[model samples]
Target: MRGRIIVLKHNTPGLLRRIASLRRSRVLQYRDAKGVILLDILPQGQCINAARYCSTLDRLKEAIRRKRPGLLRRGVVL
Candidate 1:
């Protein structure tokens, strides 16, 4: 399984709620020294499938779309 990193501009409460709601067993969180929070969405277990990866990306995209659409266009990844 591979990992997908998603970086957000700021850690907003609404964004946190969206992430918490969509977070799965494979989802992990981290923050850098600059206080930038990153969500590492990875496929679980030994096998990596498209559906899992796509779903994860879709969920995150939807959450971002609902909260901050500008981030999506401006490139959310760091």
Candidate 2:
């Protein structure tokens, strides 16, 4: 199966800096032909670097094992 990674950005406009701190988060998703395989929400100000990506992939592997055990045996394309 082939999978895709989607980055969803959530933005709020026009907030008073003094009154309230700005809040933002990023949604990271992994989906295959069937449906969403894994989803993660990154905390505000976090960036997607090698270390983070590696951790996310580790989680993804666990998810795959739990959700679709046969996928790994069949081989997957990312």
Candidate 3:
């Protein structure tokens, strides 16, 4: 089944500060046709698999923590 890709852009009003930041963050949320969250694309280009068949939010966060140690520290809340 083809899923819908939702890109969550950072809504912070500081355009200059966002550009000046070292890491250009991007969050992509994938959902199925029924509106169920499948997975998420985190900053630093990491994909967190949160599909209904496998994996959960906590597991995904742990995976992210392992992949990018500095991501959580940068104030990016998943």
Among all candidates shown, the one with the greatest TM-score:
2
* Model 1 regions more than 4 Å off: 1-26, 30-48, 75-78
What local lDDT does model 1 show for residue 24? Answer: 50
TM-score of each: 0.37, 0.65, 0.30
User: Candidate 3: which stretches are off by over 4 Å?
Assistant: 1-55
Candidate RMSDs in Å, in order, are 8.7, 10.2, 12.9
Consecutive 10-residue window with the lowest summed lDDT within model 2: 11-20
Per-residue CA lDDT of model 3 for 1-78, tens digit only, reads: 123333334433654344335254443344334342333334465554556225556655675566555657979655
For 1-78, candidate 1 gives per-residue lDDT tens digits of 334444466665676556545545355554435543336545335344698667756766666666565767976444
Q: Is candidate 1 or candidate 3 better by lDDT?
A: 1
Top lDDT model: 2
Model 1, global lDDT: 0.55
The positional error of residue 32 in candidate 2, measured at the CA in angstroms, is 0.8
lDDT of each: 0.55, 0.67, 0.47
